[model samples]
Target: MSVSIIKCNSYRECRAGIDKALSLIGGIEKFVHPGDKVVIKPNLVSKKRPDSAVTTNERFVHEVIKITEAAGGVVTIAESPGGPYSAVLLKSLYRTCGMERAAEGTAAALNYDTGFTEVSYHTGHTLKSMPIIDPVLEADVIINLPKLKTHAMTSYTGAVKNLFGVIPGTHKAELHFRLNDRAAFCSMLVDLCERVKPTLNIMDAIIGMEGDGPTSGMDRHIGLVLASASPYELDLAASAVIGYAPNEVPTVREAIKRGYSPKDAAKLDVMGESIEKVRIPDFVKPESHFNLLKLIDLPPALNALVVEKLASRPKIEYDKCVSCGECARCCPPEAISMASGRPVIDKSKCIRCFCCQELCPKSAVRIKRSLLNRFMVNFLK
Candidate 1:
């Protein structure tokens, strides 16, 4: 399968760009059939404005809904946000992210269903099962719409990483706590891609997030809309465009190891814009992407010392905190707690998932790297 990369400088041209990209890959009609229950899975991670680059562009979603309608498919926008999952919270997030506005006049509707189904995803990996959001499981066609961004935890968040949202609510915490190691979590992610392979994967890279993202990052004008049948291939292109070695991303790395993706991406049938023409040389990656430890097979004693000595932990800023208890409520390891209207993070118990940081609306959760980690980070760079 080929990856289609089209230039869309702004959300104003999102429709045209999307149409051209889809047409090159046999059109939306090729996948979605009449009367199909289509699920549009966008990266609605939080209640942030589209310009913040925390979520997918609403205009793009509207345009896709229009295309799906023309193809005679019933489209429903579905995403389980990072914090507690509820109709009220989901509705608020939808409203803030302009998704509710997209759903207002369009045939597409926002998913309010909060139920989950325990899916047995036997991809021959450590993770054999996951609790998939009900709407995703019930849909006949899943159109993954991911936003290109840098993740503090995974280093890259693209098409494959985006599917992690399918594990609804606090159940995501279970995965994070259980598979605490980055490589293990990433293997589970790759296995997930194998299990719930979306019919199509489209990306919103018009304005991507960089420097500690998935949330709380600076906006980057990438000016591109991408599409592919394989999310893995699409992410390969995305990672390259943003100056990341494809293997640097856990999902891509694991996919390559599993023989699910080509190691030499030059083999991909690339169409539309050339990767050379759109590639950014100095795109900002997360500051604490010091995951080289995972590649080295250190002894148990050394591993413990390395993790304890160099690992970055979350620190709550009292002045910036709203005392909403979001960090405590969403922490995968139950590491944070609210005390006297302030959030206290237990570094000993913290698994460093950054779920608290990703979910913190105030951007109050900051990454506090050890002195050794800071020095080593600069040394490595």
Candidate 2:
């Protein structure tokens, strides 16, 4: 497999830059054929604008639609952004993420289909089958557009992680609460990628979030766009671009364990600029990540104490919290509640999925890490 990395300074130049990236990988026509139904799935995880680096850039989305149209492929932009899953909610999401404006004057249509078709995952890693939105299942080709960002749970959010958007509404939260462990949860993510099998992946790294990301974080200038046919290899390559050891991401680690990606990523024929040329030297990692725990040799009581010590728990800052109830609505296990004017987290019930942190628009939730936990995370990395 081959991956293309190009320098894309801004959205104004995204089209030419995307074209160049596609050209390096044999162009868009190679994937989109005439009369094919193309579904472009992008990261619309929240209601934030593109400049916040919380969602995929609309300019990039528009360019992909244009290319698919040029290839005579019928295009639809589909994604179940965070909120109620319905035609009404999707329509609102389309406007929030600029999907409606991006598809305007283009043959691309914005999807508001609330219907879903269940398919067997067969990966058997975590799920047997999942209900996917109709647009993805009906598409002849799927074009994945993902933003490069840090994820508190998975460590990195890139090609493989973005495909999780296909799971449709509340099922996403249910899985997060069930397989709360990063390692176990990533098995589901890998399975989703295998089942979805996108025809192509285009990464939006022109502006990426770092620190406490995928939702709340600082936007930094990454100034690049990437394309790959294999999401696994694309993630492997993206990890390098972000200056992360591929193993730092649970999805990448899981892929390596399952031989989805080889340990020697040097085997890939990387086109365009070298990773070193565009790599972020000071790129930040997620503020909190899962800890490696082994309790086989320890006493049960001691193991429980150690587990509590090593894990980073979410804490709501009384001063910063807005008491919006968004956290309560998204807490997969229903662990958070609004008390008076503050959000109180049930530490015992908290799954550490960081859904509360990710959904907190006010950035009030902080990942509270103990000193020992901090040292352990660094050592493990």
Candidate 3:
């Protein structure tokens, strides 16, 4: 597998940055042809501004659309918001990221409601058919433009995680509730990626999120754009730069096991800047009930039951929580309820999918880790 990287300085240079990155791997002409219906799926998880580093840089998306259109392809920008799947959010993202102006100027349309289609994947597991955004399914070529950000649940969100946007907002919560366990959830993510099978994957690493990420986190500049045909390979490369081992990341490991790509960096060819130069500081992984599963030795059946029973939904820090109800609204199982002007978690029904933590607008929800849990984690590490 080949992955290309270009050292970009700022958003103003995005067009040149994309040109340099793509040229290193073959050009837009190679991946997209004339009259092709190209869908550019950027990370528009929320309505956050570009500097927040929570979503893909609008400049990057604009550059991709510009290149595709110049190469004689019809381009359309689309995404399904994380929770509450609202056109309001989509419009807000476009406006805040300056994508609205870019789209209009480039003659590309912004689609919030493209409808849905059923796509089947032979996971050989329990899940058979999955619903995905119809525009993604029907597109002749999908240029996956994802933001390079750290995720509390997945360690890092790169090319592979971006595919999650393909699942319609209405069904995302259901999937989270169904695949509650980390391993199971990772399997579901891989299944979705397999069905979508993006033609090309590009990561906007010019500015990346760290600390409690994907949605809420601190913005740090990394100044790079990465591209590859294989999402798994791109993720592996990005994870290493963030000081994470490929095997330790559940989703990348699961993808490798499913015959996607080799998890080891030595097995793949990385083009462009040296990994040493692009590496960033390590990020903290979110707390999960599964961490306890590693400490105790129990039967698989009993272990599963224990995890289900002990898993906790996110707890709100009232002082920090704005009571925006973003956490309550995004709760996959609807386990979070606003009772007396504060968010409460229904532990019995919580799935520990971390969607609440991932989508919390205020970054108010944090995994309530006990002292024992902290000690165990330190000892294990």
lDDT for residue 367 in candidate 3, whole number 0-100: 71
TM-score of each: 0.95, 0.94, 0.91
lDDT tens per residue, model 3, 44-88: 877777778888887788789889999988988888877656677
On lDDT, the candidate that comes out on top is: 1
TM-score of 2: 0.94
Best by TM-score: 1
What does the lDDT come to for candidate 2? Answer: 0.85
Worst 10 residues of 2 by lDDT: 287-296
Give per-residue CA lDDT, model 2, range 79-151, as digits (tens).
8865468887787777877888889889888888888888886656888888788899999999999999888
Per-model lDDT: 0.87, 0.85, 0.78
**Which of 2 and 3 is the better model by lDDT?**
2
